[model samples]
Target: MRAVFVRPGGGGVEVRDVDVPEIGEGEILVRMRVCGIDGTDLEKAFGRPITPPMLGHEVAGEVVESKTSEFRPGDRVFVHHHVFCGRCYYCLHGSYTMCPLFLKTTIEPCGLAEYFRVPRTNVERGAVLKLPDNVGWEEAAFIEPSACVLRAINRAGFRPGDSVSIVGVGPTGAIFIRLLKSFGASVVAAADLSSFRLEAARRLGADIVVNPLEADFPEECRGATDGRGVDIGVLATPTVKPLQTVLDTIRKGGVLLIFGAPEKGEKAEIDFSKLFLRETNIVTSYSTSEVETNLMLSLIASGRVSLRDLITHRFRLEEAEEAFQTARDAGRSLKVVVEA
Candidate 1:
């Protein structure tokens, strides 16, 4: 089987002939249909928190073989990227993602391969969900990221009539905008340096789009909320500046959600006096779990969220390099998928 893997020492991904993963008891084998190339994949390729073995996590495919009776050959499914240990302290306390074992495990042989193995833990623990007939492989591949957005929005706790401001109109940011609107937010504003992303955000139902480079973003957000500032501000860019902007745009007693993963060791300064006196809150979200992933799958299947509009490009496994390049230059692209 052919697989795209990260070479050691920050080298680019290389196509290699690797053995197909073997299925264990209660495990399932999926014939890869489509894998979403994320910003994390770019970070991994550059050797940030470098880990060997499989890399791709946002995957969807047909069940080629299975040892469990719950699933069988020809069943379409979406694979959950992370697996949690049920006996861990975090799991016992309902903080499954914080479990040490979940962080230690990786999807064997990665998602960017001709075939990959689904762990017994994921299958038995309800990590994998059957894809609906109306959803195609490309749209189903978005389930992972959509689940992440769902988790972030849930943590932010937006009220039905709350004013919302989102910084960064990338794939994740755009998804956040759509979800926020669906939650009945009264005012939805999105900011990004790229006009392409801002346009994409508009298409995703953002009420207002602001180009941070050409406008006073904080002032614009403030004006949009009638000088009270937005009720909630979501920082969806990996840059530290956006975090500060989120803080500035959020009103007193408002919430700030940091949804983007900044580079390691990144730092930003904030006005402690404002945070203290205003009683503002700051929160960050990481990966998604089985529970949230299942919800996102349902939402996608129901047509409440459109994953089709988010996919702007697709590449084959052999075009992995080109796909990475396109993702790196995200100003012109939204979500890029690599098909098997």
Candidate 2:
């Protein structure tokens, strides 16, 4: 088998031959169809590492071997990378992602491989689902990311007719735009340095788009909302500057959803007085739970949302380096996929 490995010391990805993982008693081996490249994969390839050896996570495939009665060979599916123990306190409190068990398990090797294993713990807890017949590999590949975006929107208390300013129009921001519109958000303006991403946001239904280089993003977002500011501001990229500047782009008492995860100890100072006086609330989201994954799959199955358009680049397993390079330059690509 061949898998993409993140080279040590912040270099890039490498495709190497490796022995296929042996499935455990209750596990299933999945034959990869397509795997979606996320920002974290690029981070692992060129920046600091988040997960070990493994990188990619957005996976969709067919069951090649099943040891449990719940699945059979040739069954098409979308496998979640994380599964939480529903019996835990964190799970009981609706913070499923915070459950300790959720963080400990993952597919063997990585999602960016010819094949991988789904553990029994994940299967017993319902972390796997059969892809609908109409859903293509690209759409199934969206299950994880869409589930993540759904979690953020739900936690942020988003409502119909609310206006939102999305800072950093990358793949994640594009998902936010599409979902916010479906949720009935009225004004959706995106701010980014990349014209390629901005155009992608426009296609995804962003009502207005602005480049931070050409204009004041905060001011432009405020202008679209009668000078009061948008109801919500999303810092999608979590760049040091945007972390400090997005606060000025929303209305008093509005919400700021930090969807991007910054590296450990990466700090940015903010105006405490302004934050307190305005009653600005900061909310964050991490990972996806089975709750949103089910809904996301349905959304794609029903054709309520289309993901094929978001995937602008595709590569084979051997083209890992080129794929990571294109993903690094946001000016050229949106969603990059690696096929089996």
Candidate 3:
């Protein structure tokens, strides 16, 4: 079998022949169908590298072998890469993503492979979700990212009809727009430097779209909310450049949700006194556990939301490098997927 691995020292992705992953008791082997290329995957490939170097996680596939009766060889599913131990302190506190076991557990050899093993721990914890017959591989590939957005909304205690502002209208940002509107947000203001993404946001139901380069993002957000500022401000880009800008777009007592994880050592300057005086709250969301993934799956299955249009580019596994390049071009592309 062949798998995509991030080239060491940040060059790009390389496909190499590797032995097929073997399944053991309570484990399952899945043949990859399609996997979404995430911003983190591009970071690992062309920027700084993170541990394990397993590139893809937004994946969907078919079970080729199963050792547990919970799933069969022919099951078509979306497998979550991380699962928490329900007994851990984090899980007990409802911080499932912070469970120590969550980060340590993952799909074997990564999701960007011809085949990968679902560990017993993940299987037992209900990490695999069967796809509805109506869902396609691309739609299934969106489960993880959508789950992540759902967690951020949950953490921020988002209220329906609250005015929202998104600082980065990338693929995930688009998801935020779709979900927020479905939940009855009164208005959504999307900001991005890229006109392409701004247009995409408008098409996805944003009431207002602003190119920060052309207009003041904070002003635009405030203008849309009748000068009260947005009730919720979301930072969806991985860079900290727009952190304070996003923060400035929130109303007093509003919530600023940092949904993007910046590279280590990246810093942003903000007015601590202003935040304190204004009663502004800051919330950070990490990866999702099965709790959010299941909800995301149900939403997709129930036709409450669709991610099909967010997929702007698709490539074969052999064209993984090209896919990475396209993903890097945020001005032109949204979600890029690699088909097996």
Error of 2 at 270 (Å): 0.9
lDDT of 1 by residue, 129-181 (tens): 99989989988899999898898887788778999899988778878888888
Off by over 4 Å in 1: 50-54
Model 3 weakest 10-residue run by lDDT? 45-54
Better of 1 and 2 by lDDT: 2
Model 3 collision count? 0
Cα deviation at 311, candidate 1, in Å, is 0.9
Superposed model 3: Cα runs more than 4 Å off: 49-52
Model 1 TM-score on a 0 to 1 scale: 0.95
Which pairs clash inside model 3? none
Worst 10 residues of 2 by lDDT: 46-55
lDDT of 2 by residue, 140-255 (tens): 88889989999999899999999999898778888899889888998998989988888888888898888888889888878888998888889899355687667888899999
TM-score of each: 0.95, 0.97, 0.98
Write down the lDDT of every candidate, Cα atoms only: 0.84, 0.87, 0.89
Off by more than 4 A, model 2: 50-53
Residue 141 deviation, candidate 3, in Å? 0.6
Candidate 3: lDDT of 57? 96
